[model samples]
Target chain A: MSFSIDQILRGDIPRVERPPAADPSLVPVRLRVNGQDHDLQLEPRVSLLDALREFIGLTGTKKGCNQGACGACTVLVEGERVNSCLTFAIMHQGKDITTIEGLGTPDALHPLQAAFIEHDGYQCGYCTPGQICSAVAMLKEVEHGDASHVTSDLMATDVQLTDEEIRERMSGNVCRCGAYLGIVDSIRAVYEQQKGQ
Target chain B: MRAFTYTQATDASAALHAALQNPEAKYIGGGTNLVDLMREEVERPNEVIDINALPFSQIEVLPDGGVRLGALARNSHTANHPLVRQRYPVLAQAMLSAASPQLRNLATNAGNLLQRTRCYYFYDTTAPCNKRQPGSGCAAIHGVNRIHAILGTSEQCIATHPSDMAVALAALEAVVQVQGANGTRRIAMEEFHRLPGDHPEQDTTLGRDELITSIDLPALPSTANSLYFKVRERPSFAFALVSVAAVLELEGEQIKNVRLALGGVAHKPWRARTAEEALLGKPATAENFRQAAEAELQTAIAYEHNAFKIELAKRTIVRALLTLAERQLLA
Candidate 1:
């Protein structure tokens, strides 16, 4: 279900040849998901979350709202976390994608995964994957000195990762089970460990 | 969702050509809004043109002491860009106060400017919404419309523009660079988005076949004391209930210059030109700020559930201006 640039453009190598009006409903999309490339023939309207969960057989990413309102479908695309439900599968051509499945294994867990378990970060576990993925990116953002909405001084070059900052940054992923305290503790543990390392 | 054809365009002209080829085709940059609408069946495009690869992601410094921002630049990137953060802190704060970080990372400058309203009726296809389908009666007129517009609304629609960035742009007087079938032209941000007078279906002044290539911001050095204050139902990931973007310049005690624009109140960004005019040479005091807010909101017409917005908008404006004035004192 994958097509080269030529097959997509429907002509010679360089010039783009518009495909005829035959079977334009489905497009051949190639996705690199969780360190694996998957060739999926999908409808143009299929979301990236659907392509990952249904097409690629990866169900780690949860679909809470199926809209961008909730961060349940968060996934790292090209090292940046984005809402998978809000983007088309065909848009991500050759980008690096990392899902919750790629985060850790049963025997060996990522620090965030271990901290979540220790801190009891999940009561229902529906938003754990998105929470972990978003926390991973949030750490990188803090390391890069990216300020959050709660950051008082916009001109400050250095931003310390406070509890308020973590809460504000992780506000996208809503845990309906009221496990916010546990989630905050888990993220803080990981941040502290990263700084120590 | 309905099936559609998809194609990727590497340049701006190619994307415009594809859009011209199919009248029902839509150019998708981040797809944060359009993709959701397509899933809800509110928007059914026969073709979707991918324009993410266009070289419109750079933040350029114009020779005439201005900034030119490419259309494809992500919201997070633009908000955090050194030039924007330093020169236009209000714009940065506005963008930061918008949707979640993940969305801001994916939403582009042009897409943010062109995002549709988040009215529940507008998103619910089963409900009657003239913005979603022209000639369809507006359900928000009598339905649960706590989030409906209170200013610049017509009988046809009460939907408000949902972009926090647009409010700041309107206050800063940014210009939109559009490339259409005819040619390239620049549209002032003030005149770029139109009010829902008779036709609520048409959102912005962007033509059906036009592509927004970039946005140009004229230098406002006095806007160093600018800020964006947003009040939402929740702290994050929610649209503004009443947001204000204010820029203040003070000479000793009197106000030298001021700019004000409001969100969640109208079909477009409600620029407080009257407020700015009233506070031009007035003293930088809370009383003057309140008077300016009242002067700008004189023509406001609020619906049943949204009458509180008039008072809320006025308080937010005064608060924003007073905060900026206090910052000037501290500086």
Candidate 2:
């Protein structure tokens, strides 16, 4: 009745039969996560966050304030960041979902992850995955010339990642440890390193 | 969350047909607010229809220069669209000021317009909220109501609309395109959202079967010189206490045209027509802006916990207009 995350990632599980729309039974959901395909039979209301943790067994994405108030469940969908808790698993069938576990492993950490350890970006570390995941997409957003609430020049194609800009962009993730100074430093470090490259 | 059936509609007609077949079916796009409400048992639909497959996610520019935002377009995409950022910067600013980046990435433009209030009483099922259950009585009227509405409030509900993008859309005088079994039609932005009068349960004028297709922003050169000012409990990631969206056009030293809308102060976006009229043909000065703001807030009623909102709203309006005027001078 249960399968390991590795087995599921290896396509050991066959796709389940998709139930009719009128049937109130558990519907079949196909999710491609971190370049792996997962077929799960779930209720219509299962959130993407729950599906990732409970069904797919990728529990790195923390669930904080399941009502989308906090960003502990932040994940990348098609290279863009979103709160996994706020969306339904059935809704993201075709999108590419990237959770914290999908990011660089312990052996080869994502640049932000490496920078987080160097800068001590977390204390309890519950919000670290979400913060790092959010920072990963936040850098891409800025590189794509996306403006924030704090951005004064809306029409500018070039965006400068100031301290205020990073704080505003990462406001969704709440850290009880008050490790924002380190979080900002980690993101800035990676940002500067990337810019220099 | 209740057990429900799920269906992904391939087209608009199919979505409408499925909705017509199931009375308890809810069409979901983004699901940022709907899914949360469903988890809280605030919304219980027997069936959930996925409308993401429909081709209503494009951000197109009309031949007349106005922008057409597809109802299903993500908030982050719509806000960052070059047309919206260059010509409708106020809307971009308002949307960016409202939610976190993660939320903006998932939330859609039409869903933002249809989002319910952030009133504490409405969210707490234990509390009596007329908006949640009609005729249940309102708890926020006497309870903690610092975030309640100050304008267009009835005894049944004092909740304010929690949308910064809608406030900017109201100031821009956008139009909403909707389709139902009866066919397609458009509703003005000012008429799209309804005030909570005797019936607090109804949030908008949109019918249950009507599906919002797109939002059309009218081409206005004045919107180029616009600003969105939001005052929240925190620097970011909080609902607005008093937000102002101002579009100002200056003719020499006089105000040629002005559109003002106030958010976090009303059941719907409060279009400051009185203030717009007051500032029309007047000198573009800080004193005049203050007078116009006061005129707009003359009829704003406040509750016990939110009397400061009235003053805050007026000051924010004046500040927004003054900022826009200063920007015009520099330009």
lDDT of 1 by residue, A47-155 (tens): 8998999999899998878778779999999888999999998899799999999999889899999999999999999999999999999899888878788888878
Best by lDDT: 2
Error of 1 at A30 (Å): 1.6
lDDT at B308 for candidate 1? 91
Clashing pairs in 1: none
TM-score per candidate, in order? 0.94, 0.95
Q: Native contacts retained per candidate?
A: 0.64, 0.81
Instruction: Point out where model 2 deviates above 4 Å.
Output: A1-24, B222-224
lDDT of 1 by residue, B151-188 (tens): 88899999999999999999999999998878999999
Give lDDT for model 1: 0.88
Q: After superposition, how far is residue B327 of candidate 2 from its true place, in Å?
A: 1.6
Per-prediction DockQ comes to 0.31, 0.38
B175-285 in candidate 2: lDDT tens per residue? 999999899999999999989999889999998888999999999874358989999989999889999998989988789999999999999999999999999999999
Label model 2 with its docking quality class: acceptable
Q: CA lDDT of each candidate?
A: 0.88, 0.90
